[model samples]
Target: MTNERSLSQKWADFRATKAQLFWTGIGCAVATMVVGFTWGGWTTGGSAQLAAAQAGTTARQELAAAICVDRFNAGGDATAQLATLREMSTWERGKFIAGGGWVAMPEMMGKTDVAATSCAAQLVATPAPQAASTAAP
Candidate 1:
């Protein structure tokens, strides 16, 4: 017989090496996936969707809070209302804001609870202007 080896014979001769290469490739793939997910900030589709939903909710709440603040400040008795709101306990502030109809925007119908709470926080954080009093020097 001639001293030449056919493709099938060569393949058969390297069967052990072939298996080793295959296993090595599999291990490398698994390692890359593990590293990428653990430290590369790679997010799955489900996690990305959840994050997007949460961001949307936060944006909506902030927008509604802004509108609520504007409406509240535009009222004729804003100073008096602000004083009253500041006197109430923290837990009652949201209810007071909601009752004032400041969080009644079209986009805030069912989501008024969170918006009202945010509005109350913004209102509380802002200092109301003091009334000027006349006094004799």
Candidate 2:
């Protein structure tokens, strides 16, 4: 009877050990899944932010290019038109335009008559210095 009782105790201990191991494995699996989900969320968020930033940049560049083109069409001197184009550099125009080119945004793809007329007016108006100089001469 003593030997039989000892064997039963051993069996109970072995069963307890197995249960503990099973729970431990489940915990590890849960941890791995959480980590994977967190990583995926972070990557997706970063990509979305990057895309938005690129879109903004492109819009600004398109606006600037439209202005510059309008100025050129209005009979403004080449120098002023060039100056306007150069001013666009502060907004990183090249990168902005390039981004738009890649994404093909609707705003970048279409043109309006209003913008053309405004640019023409802006470009044709004599720059203040040029007007003064011409008056002086």
lDDT of 2 by residue, 31-135 (tens): 887887787453568888998998886566557556555434454455654455446643343343233232233564453333333344444344534443555
**Clashing residue pairs, candidate 1?**
none
Once fitted onto the true fold, the runs of candidate 2 whose alpha carbons sit more than 4 angstroms away are 1-43, 76-137
Best by lDDT: 1
* Candidate 1 wrongly placed segments (more than 4 Å): 1-16, 133-137
For residue 125, what is the lDDT in candidate 2? Answer: 49
The TM-score that candidate 2 achieves is 0.28
Q: What is the model-wide C-alpha lDDT for candidate 2? A: 0.52
Model 1 — TM-score against the truth? 0.82
lDDT of each residue in 19-115, candidate 1, tens digit only: 8999999999999999999998999999999999999999999998999999999999999999999999999999999999988878556778999
For model 1 the local lDDT of residue 93 reads: 99
For each candidate, what is the lDDT? Answer: 0.92, 0.52
Poorest 10 consecutive residues by lDDT, candidate 2:
96-105
TM-score for each candidate, following the candidate numbering: 0.82, 0.28
